[model samples]
Target: MSELLSIAQLSVSFGPVKAVRAIDLQIRRGEAVGIIGESGSGKSVTWLGALALLPGATISGSVMLNGQQILGASAKSLPGIRGKRIAMIVQDAQSALNPVLTVGRQVIEALQLHRGMDLWAAQAEARRLFDLVRIPSAGRRLASYPHELSGGQNQRVMIAMALAGRPDLLIADEPTTALDVTVQAQILDLLRDVQRETEMALVLISHDLGVIAEVCSRAYVMYAGRIVETGPVDQLFAAPRHPYTRSLLEALASLDGPLRRPNSILDGTAGAMVQQQGCAFASRCPNRAGVCSHLEPELSAGPDGWRVACLRADVAGPLEIVA
Candidate 1:
């Protein structure tokens, strides 16, 4: 299958800090890929750079959508392709949506700009989208401002706007973060349904591995600004090749499991603090070797579509593949 979106050797730098470094990722037509990482790990920055919204950020390498380069496209020319071909649902809906404007108007404006629908037509399409995303009383709600809607409702409106342009690729950065567990599941289901109906590729960036496991067919784990492990979601979850990936799963487990031991807190803390060196997880990695502190490892192919960027992958045990 041909890729709908391809990002190769892409890097985003903020003067002295490298927020993302030489990342390579792809999303095939109608496929869902997840990017999971801890806070400040460049999960959102990677896509922000792709969307050309990273202000004062220096970007290098290529971002191609449908065989066209968007990295260097002029802003004037980019809008013609941006929302129509690619759209993004930002993490914070309250800040993303205009507080002053009615949710209906905001969503219709997106349709008007890209799909070239007139006022009445755009409003009709916007109401249709509201129904599609399961927001009740669509007609009545159309007159409501952003402040009037609940957090989950605002999120639905945001998703509706993102879909208004009928984009070929959807870049969602923690789209369900503000929601409760029940609402979160519903939002994921809604996104999945929309993707299938539209035959659009999805790039889901989240800090929650469980969310990624539920929605993404393929997954990439990022650390300090680099992709540490990548593979099909089930295989990586069953047997994470990178130490950071392992720690994330373990941390997730700790959240659900009993915390009888003191090590539980310690282990969670290990996954949080930054370790800037050869290996970002070297300070806390159980299997760290002498060379791990001096040499940063490159991603190497492993079994079953698995790729790990670690010097100690050989000793990390045979990663069990989920059939």
Candidate 2:
């Protein structure tokens, strides 16, 4: 598949605090890529910065979509690109949707803006989109306000509105965060089905490894505003090269095997602190060496397009080396 989007040296800063450090990422057409990490790892900020969604953020990056630069582009050009070519569905569907407007009106507005359909046609298309997202009572639900629907139904409505634009790439940021396990499965399945049918590129951002594993073929592990590991989902899960990655996998409870005790890395979550030098994860990393405290490792290519930033990529299993 050809490259649909490329983000090069992307970074975002608020005053003296840098939320997203320089990072590079690419998404291919019709591919499902996931960004997984603990909260405050710059998973969502990467895209938000790319799309110019963060206000008061000093963003420095080159975001290219099909060879056209999106970052630092004129304000007038972004609106056309945002919903028409690229769409994003954030967590908290209730907050995303306007309380005064009916679900149908919201979807219709998107269609009218992007597809340029008349009210009558947009309403018809909205109903179809409601059906496409598997929302029951599609027609009736269209006229209902966001508060009138359940959380799952509201999320489905958000999905419907996003799909109404028929975007080429969809970024879902913790789309199932507020739902029950059953509903989460349903939403993930719906996203997969939609991607398959539409052939749209998908970027699923979540903290849940299981959620990413369910819908994404490839995954990127982020830590402290940088990508620590990336590879095919199966390979990375089976043999994680980075100590952080291994620690994250160890934290998950296995269904078939005996549950391994979670590592100390899982004990407490911390926001990315100011790191003038050295590896950002060195403070919490079990494998931290004298070098790790002084120098940051670059993301180096590994076998089969896999990549790791750890200096001791060859070291497998839990680390005995401590800072």
Candidate 3:
């Protein structure tokens, strides 16, 4: 599959504070990829900056969509591509949805804007989308306001609105946040099903590694505004390379294994708080050495695109294909 979106050397900063640094990411057509990290890891900022959606932020990088450069594209050309080619669904559906307007009206407006459908046709399409997202009473729900529906249903509506654009790529930022476990599972399953049905590229961003392992084929682990490790989900989950990745996996609760005492690896604050001239994670890293404090590790990669940024990569062994 060809790349639907490519980002290289992407950096973002607000004044003196650097939110993201030298990030590189790629999503192929119809692929489900994940960006996993804790809060303030620059996961959302990376994409938002890529689409030129961040105002007053200094963004320097190349953002290519379908082999065309879009980072610094003219304002006129950019708007047409945003919703039409790459739609985004944020975490809070309640915030994204307007309270005054009916859900159907919001969806219809998206259709009219992206698909240029008339009022009647847009309504029909909107209903079809509601059904596609498995919204109950699809026709009746159209007239319902945002507050009337459940959180999961409202998220489904958000998905419908995103799908209204018929985009080649969909960026879902923490789509399942603020939901019950059952509801979160439902929403994740829905995203997987929708991606399969639509054959659109999916970029799932979440703080939950379990969610990433559940839905994505590949994942990029972010820390201190940089991609610390990335690889096939199965491998990354089975044997994590970077210390941060290992700590993240260890933090998860296991059903079958005996109780393991929690470690203090994750106890420290986020890496962003420190002004490190070298490895940002060295301060809290378990395998930290004298060299780690003075030299930052460049992200090293194998031919399969499994990459890790750590000075002692040899301790982790090489990344290999599962099959």
Best by TM-score: 2
- How many clashes (backbone atoms < 3 Å, residues ≥3 apart in a chain or on different chains) does model 2 have? 0
Comparing 2 and 3 on lDDT, the stronger one: 3
**Candidate 3 residue-wise lDDT, 1-323, digit = tens:** 88888899999998877889999989999999999988999999999999999999999989999889999889999868888899999989998999999999999999999889999999999999999999999999999999999999999999999999889999999999999999999999999999999999999999898899999999999999999999999988887889888878777765664533354247678886334688888878867889998898999986468899999767764322322
Q: What's the lDDT for all of these models? A: 0.84, 0.88, 0.89
Error of 1 at 154 (Å): 0.5
lDDT of 2 by residue, 222-322 (tens): 99888899999999988889988888877776677466564544544553546578888777777678888778899999888899998777766742322
For residue 266, what is the lDDT in candidate 3?
72
lDDT of 3 at 302: 68
Candidate 3 global TM-score: 0.95
Reference-based TM-score, model 2: 0.96
Q: What is the lDDT of residue 120 in candidate 1?
A: 91
lDDT tens per residue, model 1, 190-277: 9999988988889999989888999999999998788999999998987777877776675554444353223322233322323356
Model 2 residue 308 CA deviation (Å) reads 0.5
Which candidate do you rate higher for TM-score, 1 or 3?
A: 3
Off by over 4 Å in 2: 262-271, 318-323
After superposition on all CA atoms, how large is the RMSD of candidate 2? 2.7
